[model samples]
Target chain A: MSERILSVLVEDKPGVLARVALTISRRGFNINSLSVGPTNIEGRSKMTIVTELESVEQVKKQLNKLVNVIKIVELDPDNTIESEVLLMKVSINKETQTSVIEKANLSGAKSVDVGQDYAVFELTGTSKELIKFEKLLKPYGIIEMIRGGRIAIQTKL
Target chain B: MTKEKLSGAELIVRTLEHLNVSTVFGVPGGAILPAYDPLYDSPIRHILARHEQGAGHMAEGYAQATGDVGVVIATSGPGATNLITSLNNALMDSTPLLAITGQVASDFIGNDAFQEAYTVGLTISATKHNYLITNAEEIPQVLLEAKHIATTGRPGPVLVDIPKDILNEKANWTEPKLEDLPGYKPTLEANPKMIQQAVELIKNAKKPILYVGGGIIHSKANKELFELSTKYNIPVVTTLMGRGAFPDGNELCIGMPGMHGNYTATTSIQKSDLLIALGVRFDDRVTANPKFFAQKAKVIHADIDPAEIGKVREPEVPIVGDAKSVINGLIEKLGDSEIDTNSWLNEIKDMKENYPLNYNQEEKGPLKVPYVLEELQKMSEEDSIVVSGVGQHQMWISLHWKFKSPNTWLNSGGLGTMGYALPAAIGAKAAFPDKQILALDGDGCFQMTCQELITASTENIPLKIVVFNNGNHGMVRQWQKIFYNHRFSASELTHHTPDYVALAEAMGATGLRMVEKSDVKRVFEEMFKTNDRPVLVDCVVDPDDMVFPMVKAGGSNDEVILNEDDLKNI
Candidate 1:
């Protein structure tokens, strides 16, 4: 029930991601969302993951024990910036287009692409704002929606 | 050094030789044949085990018997899978072992072509770390790294899986690099402030027990541990894996404390106010239920592995370092001083005298395992090595045998693998060729790996095998009888069980079966006189007999049932 965010650094190698994911799954926890990208250092990558933890400390301890994992830092909300990007194609037409556009504009949504009958609106904001924007667009009948899971950064100051 | 053109297989053997591996135990298969081709030319002795599983255990036995890391080799598919149990066994006990398994050709790896399997994936969880060689040239560095990892920092098993074609690929021989790894450094020095805190706690503790473990043996911290115990006038109780770490014959040696432990040891842990747990993992058998285990005791755990710290019961004082280094630090900090806890010592002495590890010596029944093992212990050499398989008989041997030195007692403490002793005895005998060796196994357990008697006889390993023949899996039967309303299941070995004596004889070993308690001493004495060849003693014991001072599953260690009357109330 406790969603914890973790930043994991590991040596870049084939199946290294599988290993990290495997370790979590074997311990009976599924990743809510995971993103992997190269870190500042060569031959190393950073993993941003969100998972429901029964005991965050226990999971951290286990993760720390994994041979591939170089380091694991659990982000503290007070010092962290958490956000997400979402793209939704709402079922819109001439009748509700203006109101939908006005609502989208108010909610900080930008029209990225448009087709004859559907429009793709991109919204980048904190997860709370993004979720609220999606909810507001749901009444207009969302055809398809995709979310880029939360990415976080801990501030030094 | 100039690079010599060689195949990856040749380089693997050369790397092992360069690392000074004296022996490799394994069975052959198609995928590993490339490595085996060059192995014959290598100086390392190859122990051709009957089964890959037996080979794995033999390597473990060699590692445990000697301080050196043991090497195991096997092919892919079934061969690699066979080593899983032994890998887990070594991992749990923290024995240093390196297992090299072959994989199918790279293209055929996932296709399941000719003995292909997920070798690395299968054993990753069981090993400290594992490698699947993607590049043929990196084999030496990986093996060297594997060796370094296997033998260092709370030693455990490590596996390296190499594809078959990669072994045939041309590779240049190069000297192995020796340097510090970037991230995988283990803390070897105890924090000075933490050492001071532990010293303070030790001084304050009135009723203290030194809970020693197998890590003492691995770290060679026995002398320091003894110094710590004797100086502070603390009693010592060893776990099953820790049994031989401390001298069992010492007056301060309370005995093993856990499931099937002696009454004095288990009760002492319960009553003590302080438990100085050295290199012990606080296994479930020792604690039974952590919530109720040593409720009044403040624990001080010192180990090289941080993961082991608080993995079970949280230690009030946690010292992360090599056990020897930590003990040395403690000895330096604490100084040579004996605390005045005469009242505590007297209370322990009373407890020891009140609850003796008793069995009916004069009972009119078949041979009893306790009496036989006790007799064996007395008859065996003072420096003999005793290995055991899992079962009720394993409990009996552990309870009865008195080890005078370190590395003299061996058992499958963690994984509890049945049929571990025969091959392990063979390997240990190989390690200490001049010493007397014995494998105490039960009928059910002995049957599991008794085929290794062939290796013992052929290799001229004069290991004396003792079978506690209770006509069933005694531990399982006991569990069923006690907890399951005597619901007899598949535990009975009465069906399809071959005569152990005849089986041993068929394998070129001198076999004898003793049925009466009167013959126990005479048989042990006469048989143990000369271990010129392998000997099997089938001691038919009372099937109804049960191990005492057993902590029920999930039960409090303090609430151990010592007798049938104690069980009846529960």
Candidate 2:
């Protein structure tokens, strides 16, 4: 099975999100990551859900049956601009401090939080760049890591 | 804008009146007492069922009989929980149903008060859509929207849970307005390209069959289906739910296909090259072990529910639209084009003659289930509504009865809920007072919800109920004898069985117990002549009688037992 990004448009009803989640979980399909926000249209919201499915058509058929779901369109991975924000707190020493700051500067990431024995780095980029940033920060000792999963819209032709 | 105030229960009645709902099958209890008060003043007829399960099945029967959205109501706790079986039944069979239940007052909800239960939370998974209305104002919008959801698209059961206090509270009422539902629009037309592909597939296949189901009745597409089947010269096979979909006496009809299905229908699908599945869900019973069902066939599935299209087996061409609409499209595309299926028809005819569904009444002794159904079919009118309870009797009627019209046969095919026949027959009789409605029931099945006979007798619904008394749970006993090595544990209901005649008489219904086969006709004539009240006939059938042509559970359709001797040959 391959991971497919499905962008769903749903009505803004109370417990509509729970309804969608229940439908997915009950059908035994795993949701890797998901982000929801109100769209330009009133009384409706856009949800970008990332899930690995055996058949995209089957999932589309099921989600479309829900009363709150308006439409589901599978966004092409190649024709979309997607990014995630990474928050990582790492332990460092005087020797590692210079290397960490230089790595952050080189990677275009910024230090968001600071403590005596830990410093948090915030990075925003494609999932590929975040993987590299994770590798560089691993040597210093990572205590915590959080990534806001991808939210996307199709780029204009 | 009139701001006239009304109680929650009043709003519910008004909304139902506005929606043109004429009848509701329900039982009143303490929690739902306030709602009943308003119901007494409304124009809608509220049928007082003996039990909540009876109410649910009656609603199902009403929906199946009239092709309208059926309604049922109950109180909290046990009352609401009793509806689960029929709700699941409706969900699986795609019946349009609405169940209203009373919850404990808002303050006593989680404290487990008397008759208190979390009706909404517990039934979320069992319904197509549900609502928990705590405020009185949400009643109108919730009721109307629930009706829309219940009747539109792939119809199923939806529940509305309202608190007792909410029913007591007063709320301002403007004209009923449905706030726009932005996300629930369904696709009504099929893609032309997909229809063309299906036509091409049907045209090229040498061996083709139309596997039809109950959705044909739901969409009222039997006329179109018959034309398409005749025009293409394809044989038709229906599921248990689809018993009345096609004319059973027609030349192209190959009878039912699945577990306990006819020999020709099952084997035809196995050997055919093309399966034009129309409005069928391909339920596991129809497709024995879905992994290998019709493995060689290139399927063309046309159904209203997209979720049902590829849920079990992927169709080569999926036309997602109403059954009548899709078949009309097919007829438009392939008009009067005859394909040479003579060889295939000949093979099916040979199979039908070789393994005909046969059971000798004299060899079996006192009475046979098939013989009883044959007599019932012969005596009843062509348009009579035959509602069967679950078990071997259900299969007997589904196999033997010749239903010439849609919605003439009503049974719980999915949930296999016993005690469905009697109450469902009551609902059918209520819907069609002019037409005859009969309940083909088993001894074990009749006892489950036979208390509803009081409702029928009181309400003047003269339903003819024939109970096949086999002295045990025939189906479970058959399985135990075959699969469990003759361990008849709890399967026999002879020792503590009630006197069915006495029971019926106590309930104000006519009771006729026939043990002799010679008295069948006279008893049926006398029973039918008594038009003022309902009649119950308890026919003494052979306890050892088994429904043959059986496909054992988890077994392939090819490995079917044709008869008693065939069982030994296998």
TM (chain A) per model: 0.89, 0.89
DockQ of each: 0.46, 0.56
Residue-by-residue lDDT tens digits, candidate 2, A24-121:
87788777888888999998898888888675666687788877788898988788888889998898777788788788869989988776677888
Model 2 chain B poorest 10 in a row by lDDT? B494-503
Each model's lDDT comes to 0.86, 0.86
What residue runs in model 1 are displaced by over 4 Å at the alpha carbon? A1-4, A28-33, A51-54, A93-102, A116-119, A141-146, B336-338
Candidate 2 residue lDDT tens string, B1-570 = 668899998988888888899999999888888999989988898889989999999999999999899999999999999988888888888899999999889999899899988787677667888888979998988888998888877788999999999999999875567777766776668788999999999888899999999878888889998998887889999888888788998989999888888888888999899999988988877778776678889999988888888888888999988888889999999877778899999998899988788878884368888887787677778788999999999888888888888899999998888999999999998898888899989989988999999999998888898999988999999888777888999989882268887888899999898776787888888878877899998888888888877876677777878877776654
What's the TM-score of each model vs. the native?
0.95, 0.92
| CA displacement after TM-score superposition, residue A63 of candidate 2 (Å) | 1.3
* Candidate 2 collision pairs: none
